[model samples]
Every structure is written in structure tokens, then in C-alpha cells.
Target chain A: MKVIKTVNIFLAIAILILSVNLMKPLSITGSSVADLSDAECYFVNSGVSNDIPIDGCCYEVQKQLECKKTSKDYRCYTSESSERYYVVNANALNYCKVGGYDVKII
Target chain B: MSKLSEDMSKDVKLMIVLVVVVIILIFFNFDSYGVSGEAANTDNIQYEESTNTLYLDSLTLKQKIAQMVITYHKETNKERLQDLFIGGIHMGAKTSKEEFMNSIDNFQDGSIIPMFISVDLEGCANPFENFQEFPALNEINTKEEAFKVGYDEGKLLKEMGFSINFAPVVDLDDKIWKCRSFEGSPEEISEKAKYYIDGLQENGIVATSKHYPGKTLMLWDPHKYVVHAPISRNDLMPFEKSIEGEVSAIMVSHIIADGYANSENKPSVVSEKLIGELRNKFTGLIITDEIRMLGLSDYYSDVDQMYIDLFKAENDVILNFDINLDNLEHMISVVEKAVIEGEIKEERIDDSVERILNAKGVNVIR
Candidate 1:
């Protein structure tokens, strides 16, 4: 009886872990989004900001995603250069991400 | 016997559970677990090889118009582009070198005319970002270093089957990326660009000097849809040197210019006054930056009208990277309709197509 009960518990745990893994693909953190208000944006390289030099925080557009956060009204973008995600009001950055690109990020 | 039977049954149940867990893990390993670009249906297209003797008149209006467009390459839309006979394909970032080479070879084999496989291998804005590394332009201090970097980049690009490199950015000031441009005054930058262009061209790779009217890398406020720059005589020097060196192509920027190479407050790419002036100075291919840029697109209210203006502008090659294949097809049809209505002359299309064919090493007999 103990063996059967142990097997059931193990199986349940495995299934629960799998479900959680399948839910979130992107690692968008809920932390405060970076302040990119004064940051200049480009289609290729991350433009220089008053605070950050070009080398310090250059974000080259890796793949433009189709996800548009309607509440903030900004299109999603992914960069191979930086770990942190930015939500900027720049039309150049916003317009560039208006389509399906890298399959990894939608 | 009863004890042995119970043990065997328990083992079998455990084994079954183990197998189930393994199968579940394997299923999730596939890329289908995440969201990706939609798969396009290219079933109806047929691939045909081009003969050596391709003529100017042999191509139809649609094919000629198609030859003027350079669209982004997607794995699913390979056959669709092959069917359209696009002039060129721009590759985004890719990690595996073998896979990249194979994709280039596959597209080339399917095309009737050899396509210009282009990549942004500029020092800072590298498309081969993940697996490859190259010296940034600003890091080089001498002409010899610039030439060697160009030669090496050209050799690798040629080996990988790339024909056009949109590189050797001659922009004088690069405040945005900081490292995208070579360091120096206009004269020094121009000299390095000349040497770089020579090295790249010598290795059978066509070099392009980009963002033509200068100051494209300057920092700006993001609120304005279109930004204008005052281009000076010094700002024009690098492009002038590039022109003197016979660079195969020059990419026009979206900046609205006022001085020396005046774009007349319009994006340089779509300004006839600007392109016409350039045509007089250089006889090589004049390509535009991506037409989808908001700096250019936001200038007009209607998208179709923007397409008409782009063709009317007389750029030899148009870069349109709209992800949707339908919008690309729609742009083609819209241009075709404009040609039929005489909004854009058929002779103008012939002129651009002839230039495109000549660049592709095709002998155009008119």
C-alpha cells in the first residue's frame, strides 16, 4: 500500500511541473520596466541615452515580436544585446516591432 | 506464488509510469512548445532555372518590378519569393554557419536569376551576432587594419555565398552606436572607407557605403515621426570618396536633408532631387534603406500612396521587410497597377530592371 501511494504522489508531482513549464516561454520580469524615455532608438543599434553611453546599453534589434501591450500601447521587441526588456514611447522602436519575426518570441 | 505475482504487477505499473514520464519530457523538447512565426503556404509555386542568355525584354513587367524589391528571407516563404523572382533576400541573425550556407545555396539553386544575398555585417550592427565575431569599425586606428578587416570579412562572406555587403558605413559621426563608424575627421574617414571598399571588392564581394546624406547616427528625440539633418560639405566627403572608388552600391538614408546633398526636407531615399543628383555623380546601384521605416512611412497618410512614391523615386532596389507575405504581394500589385495607369512610366521600370540585371551579371540586350 505504501509503494502504491508513493508512486501516485510522484506521478502527480511530475505532471504538475510539466504544466508550469509549458505556460511561460518568455522571461519578461514584472520588475519595474527600464526608464527609456530619453533614450534614442534605432532599427539596428541601440541609440545613446543621456544617462547610458552607447557601449553601456546598446540594444541591437534581434527579432521584432508581434505582441502589442494594448494598455501601454507599445509593441514588443527582443534584443540579443541586452538582458533587460525596455518599453519605450519611441515611434521608431514601436513601428519596427509590428510583425511576426523570430518564432521563439511572438 | 501469490507474493511473486504481486511483485511483478507492481514492477509493471512502475515501469509504465516511468515510460509515460519520459515520453512527456520528449514531447516538450520540440520547438512547438513556444510561439513562432506563422508557417506560410507555398504549395502552388514552381521553381524554374534561368538560362544564361536572359534579356531585358524577356522579363515581364511583374518580374521586372519584382527584381527591384529586396525582401526579408523567411524559411516558410522561400518558395513564395522564388515564385515572385525577387531581386534579393536580406538575412536576419542566424547562429549555425552550415545552416546559413545551406539556406543561401538552396535559394540560389531555386532562383531563375542569381539573387543578391545581403547581410548587415557592419562592425557594430552584426546580423551574425551569436556565433561569429569581428572587429568593430571604431576599433581600427590605421588604414592597413581597415583593409585587412575588409579583406577578411569579404573572404568569409564570399565563402558563405554572400554577394552584397551593406557595410563600410561612411557616416562621419556615430553618436548613437558610437562604434558603427570609423573614428576621425571627414577626410580621414573617407580615406579608410576607400581602402575598405577596395579590399572588399577585390575579394569578389560588392561593398556598399550606407546612410548616404550623413549624420544618420546622431541622437534625436523619439517623439518626431520624421527628423531632418543639415548636411554639410564635410558630411558629403565620405560618400564622394566612395563614389570615386566606384563602390558597387550606396544605401540612401531616411533622413530629411537640407544642405550639400539636399533631400529638400524629404527622406533622402524618396527624394528625386536627391537621387537624381547622386545618379549624376555615380553610375552604380542606388538602394534604399527599408521602406517600412516610420520616418519614411509616416510621411504619408495612405500606405498605397507611399508605395507609388517609392517606385516613382527611382531607387534601383527597394528594401521592404514587411513580415506578412500578403502585404509584399499587395505592394507588388499596387506598383503594377500604378505602372498600368501611367502614374509610373514603364520605361522607368525598364531602366531599374536593366540596372538590376546588369548587377546580377546578366547580359541585358535591349
Candidate 2:
């Protein structure tokens, strides 16, 4: 009876481990967002500060912040308000992640 | 007892099978576990719906002409070159050909915009004129001399990966005292221009015949201020012949042509009737003399407006000098604004950008 109980306990532990492993998450990142069809939201932060030289759409930002892309990081200013919202697809969240800033999923 | 032992073996096999299945599932799940929350959020960020092919397809007629306009020494940084929306660079006597040639290696890496290399070699006495380092072809006097000079320079430029050359001043020197002119008559100038352009093109360099509508009678350099040319249509015969010969690119002179009703008192480079109506008489590329010249700069209060006008006038390119990173960004913003306002079409922008990329020998992503 003890031998049978031991086998049953081993099988139960294996199943539990497998289920836990399956529940883990996934993410992605890069210069291009073209491949992110599955993402729920997306944002481009050209990392730069206010008072520095800027061009294109970044200049239109009312805060006068410089939006520049660095080698390994992107820089830009974002508010905690509704202005920070991004449009993205659902599967994209499974494929990529954000760096250098705190981003909330919508 | 034997049957009972067999059943125990089967149970052991079943346990092994379950463990194998669990291992396989964990291995596949590992990839998902590695993704961070930050990356997941980034993937969900909103982006404009644009494809690589769509970007390439957005070229317009005006932008196509803009692509043919080449500049030298105006803007040096990647961001600034992006603003001019130009297809090439015309390196003047001031730029060292060797150093300029060596810079091509750096361009192999991708950039937001592309630039081509073109150099002015007329009246350049320096050994490194047009970036040719060889000892034999520095000062081209005879047709035979021009052959070697053109061939060797074109070869070097090609090896260095330059795609264009704005050279072989085809202007007739009617006035012997003019230091800039090389003492060639209209016929001789035409012949030499043909030979020089042909030699360079043969070696895979796009040659540009410049100082269009001629520059023989200008009293002062247009780079400092507006210079008047006293010559008539007869004096511009060489330029007409260059167009007839199908030169790849032609640069308009800043000097206003005398007795020409539409262009008098106005530099031919900026005049709509000249660059647009008259120059458009031909099919090749039409480029302005230089945007930073006092002739154009003094007249236009807003520099961005000048580019918009030039685009509207149908000239393919504008040569910009005294441009740096900051100014380039402003120029790009101006163009973007123009697009947003419907003053310029997105197709025109893409066309110019593609030409710039082609001149740089890089593949356009769109």
C-alpha cells in the first residue's frame, strides 16, 4: 500500500510542475514595431529632454521636450494622464516589452 | 507471480511517460517565461499602419525631381541630410577627395536619410581636387588629358563607392580675363563636357554639367550677393547643348540672365519660369545653384518657404550650404508640416528619399 501511495504522489507532483511552467509569460523589443500585430498597445519614446534640439512631430509636443533615439535606449516625456495612452494589438503584448520607463497595459 | 511483476513494470513505464510529457511542456513554456513586463507593454504600443512597400510607393513627381537635386558641403550630419531630402552631395574644391572617398565606408551603416557625393573640379588647382590622389590627372588641359583624368577620377570615386560627380564646367570663356573660365569656346566646351561626362559615366559615376544658362559675364561671385549676367540666349547655347546631350544632372547658375523677361533681376536658380518652364524643356535632373547663396538667402525671409516654392516650381533638387544638425531638423519639420498641410504630397517626399538612398548605394527600406 505504501509503494502504491509513493507512485501516486510522484505523478501528482509532476503534473503540478507542468501546469506551473505553462503559466509563465513572454515579451519583445526593437527599433521597429511593424512586426507587432498581436500587441495590445505600442509607444515610441525617442529619449530626449526639453530644451535640446528636436525635429518632426516631437517639436509639436507642448512641453518642448527633445525626442531623440539613442543607441540602446529611447527617450521622451510622458504624463500619467490619459495623454499617455497607446494603441496596440493583444498578441503584441506576448511578443515584446518596454524598456527605460514604466508602462502600464491598457 | 510473473504476471504481477509484469504489471509493476507497466506501471513504471507509465510513470516515465508522464515525466517525459512534463519535461516537454516545461521546455516550450521557458520561452514565454523569459519575456519581461516592460517588453510586453512595448509590444502593445500603438503604431501607424505603414508597410515597407507602402513607404516606397509614396513617391511623387515633385519628389522625383527633388531626388535628382544634389548638394555638397551644406549639411554634414545624418539628421540634417534627412531634412534637405536631397539625393546626392556636390563636394566642392574645399572638400578633400580622399577624405570624402574614405567617408563612404561609414555610410554602409543605415541612416534615416541617404546622400550622394559630387565634386566641382573646374579651376581647382589642388592635387586633391575632386578627391583624386593620383599624380597624373590633376590639371586636365587636353582632351587626352581629360580622358585619363575623367577615367581615373571616376574609377577612384567608384572604388570609394561614390555614385556621382558634378564636374566639367561647360561654360564658354568669351572674356579672356575671367579667371574661373578655362579658355574654352562654346564648341570646345561642349566637346570637353561630353568627353568628361562620358568618361565618368563609363566608370559608373553619374556626371553633372553645371553653371547652367552659362556664367561667363558675371562680375562678382553669387555666393556673396546677387550677380548679374549681361549675356543673352546666345551665351546659353552651351547649356542647351548639354541638355541635348542628355547630361544626368544640371546645376542652375545664381546669376540672372540679361534680356530674359522672366529671369531678369532674379537668379535663374530660384526663378520658376527658368528652372520650371525653361529648364524643364529637358528631361534630366534640374538643381539650384546653392540655397545658402546670398542671392536666394537675402530674398527669402523664411528658408523653409523657399524649399516649398522650389518644390512647387518643379525643380528636382536644392543645393544647401551652411546647414548643420539643428537646421536640418528644422528643415525636416518644415517638410513634414508641408505634407500635413497638403502643400506637398507624401509621394513626393518618398521619391526624393529614394533617390538619396540610391545615390548613397544603399537599399531603400520601403
What is the docking quality class of candidate 2? incorrect
- Fraction of the true interface contacts (Cα pairs closer than 8 Å across chains) found in each model: 0.07, 0.14
**TM of each candidate vs. truth:** 0.73, 0.54
**lDDT of candidate 1 over B1-366, digit per residue (tens):** 999779768866875786587567647633323112323232332333364456566565667788899877676777778777788987765656787798899888867678889887876645554556677888878888889889988988999999899898888977755677999888899999988888898888889998888888774445664778999999899999999988999999888999888888788888989998998888889999877655676576666787788889888999876666656766776788789889999898889888887777776766
Reference-based lDDT, each prediction? 0.69, 0.48
- Model 1 residue A39 CA deviation (Å) reads 10
For candidate 2, the per-residue lDDT at B175 reads 30
C-alpha positional error of residue B13 in candidate 1 after TM-score superposition, expressed in Å:
70
lDDT of 2 by residue, B1-366 (tens): 998778777777777777687777766554333221222111221223342222344443323343455543333354334333445554432244455555554442343344566554343322243333432222346666666677777887688666666665666652311222434556666666666676787787877776777763334431234566766564566667767766677777666666642464676776777765654477656666655444554456656676676665555666643323233333444555576688876665555455544544445656
Highest DockQ scorer: 1
